[model samples]
Target: MRVFQLGLLSALALASVPAQADHHQEASSQQAEHLDAGRWVTLGTRAGPVTSATRSQPANLLVAGDQNILVDVGDGTAGQLAHLGIQTAGIDAVFISHLHWDHTGGLAAILGLRAQTNAPPRLKIYGPPGTAELVSGLLASMVPGATAGYGVPGAPRADIQQMTEVVELRDNASVELAGMTVTVRNNTHYSFAADSDLARRFESLSFRFDLPGRSIVYTGDTGPSAAVEDLAKGADLLVAEMMDVDDTIAMVRRNNPNMPPQVAAGMERHLREHHLLPKDVGELAARAKVGAVVVTHFAGREVGDPAHLEYLREIATNYDGPVVIADDLDVF
Candidate 1:
């Protein structure tokens, strides 16, 4: 196994960093040192839409050669990018795993910032079906700003339509972009039956990125899934989302004290059915035979916390490969 370095921020420091801080200089310096390597930067590791002082939302930066692709633009992505000294205009493309808000919340910032800077047009955004609709809505929401560019009367407004191009992917879809072959497989994040209309209309996807010397598979957000396992087979790295079922449920209940029993039960069922547990990750990694695992999209405990150590132990049960409980900005 190859050695990898953690970000400058210790797990405890990362967990203690004020969520409101604009950026961390230490993290920025560490990221700068790694700018030349082909790596995955865990820009945001938190799961769900809930805010956290310790973690940002789900997002990742795939630095492959000269291409800077965003795997998932969750909320706070823009700010996180700033920490790495990356301008929004520097992004070459975006690959969205699913349409969940927590996964796509920062897309507006990406689009808006790029447009404002007059970056090259047609910033490609790839995702599952309905992606075009999502982008269209975001463009619509930006009309007011586009129409009033610099408060200059009659100045040519930035054309939102020309600023972005959306490609909607489907199960077993493949595309080549930025010198990488990106493939998608429908995962178990959504429970709808294959033949149902809802399933046709909505898809939760897992992606495998094959770059020059490395391959990384991202299990966006999913439960136990054969398709995901198949997609991740023999990859150099598997960047997966993991959940602590009980802790997530407790967090939800605490946040919504008024949540009725049925509602809470339903939410718990969804969490259990739509997300991966540590054991599930271990099983997937073991079955897929991935080279390594970097766990992100944290849902329960902060990395380095006592409980977080148990997560590694759980994964070690089935997979003996290296496992990392990633914190934000960690590069691998």
Candidate 2:
């Protein structure tokens, strides 16, 4: 399932810049992997909370037999589902990778839209500890506007309270639902000191979904983690987040040229520790022996960015498996 390869040395700084000649290689090979019926489809691939012209924030749709599940509900998730001709009400459950806005931004929309139509008994949402509180806050903020149709004359009342259910998943939690076996593990995305409040209050998670004959692992924004590798071991597909370290630093510099040295250094540290570089991603996938890797949550990748080919080459250095640089709506 491998695509292209390179014998070039691992050059991070130089690899950040796009090469005009590499665009054709990407175009020719980008569609190498195709989604079979009832498989995974990438709904959004962009990282960060900000919306970009190239990709959506971070979301994916999984069709396992009769079940329709959402991996993460990022911004524009509803629209992407509509674009894919999937009904919002048909989602059996949503797995929130973490509480980051980019991963949970479309949650309210999902709740509201489904309630607008034939609401399910309860839309199950699984996430870390703060999920209940987060949903409470969202509902509070949507008081007047989102709840306006609750009791309109000649319209069926929508039960905002019972319309959704939040399930907080802890590390090592395993469950069976939606015709799949779901196992969860905590990842090292939010790295804070053990005694710090941030560490105590925030948790990042990765999920593994096992169907009858296939397994998929979604590594929600994380640095290199043994837990993630173990969870994704021998998976049929690994959907992961990848960042270009050099490009990230360059992007920060371009945005804030006059930023303080300490602040800039901190930004670089976060990029290195909080996100996966292409090499790290490749090595992780290789070590896990996953059948293929579908890279989402692109941090510094732009549409038609030729530097992305170098990224693929970097991944190929370690992984001999297929690496699909996913765009919004790409299915595999």
TM-score of predicted structure 2? 0.83
lDDT of 2 at 272: 80
10 residues in a row with least lDDT, candidate 1: 8-17
Identify the candidate with maximal TM-score: 1
lDDT of each: 0.85, 0.77
Error of 2 at 325 (Å): 0.5
In angstroms, the error of model 1 at 115 is 1.4
The TM-scores of all predictions, comma-separated, are 0.89, 0.83
Question: Could you give candidate 2's per-residue lDDT for residues 180-243 as a string of tens digits?
Answer: 7899999988888979997777789999988764678999989999999999998877889998
* Residue-level error in angstroms, candidate 2, position 114: 1.7
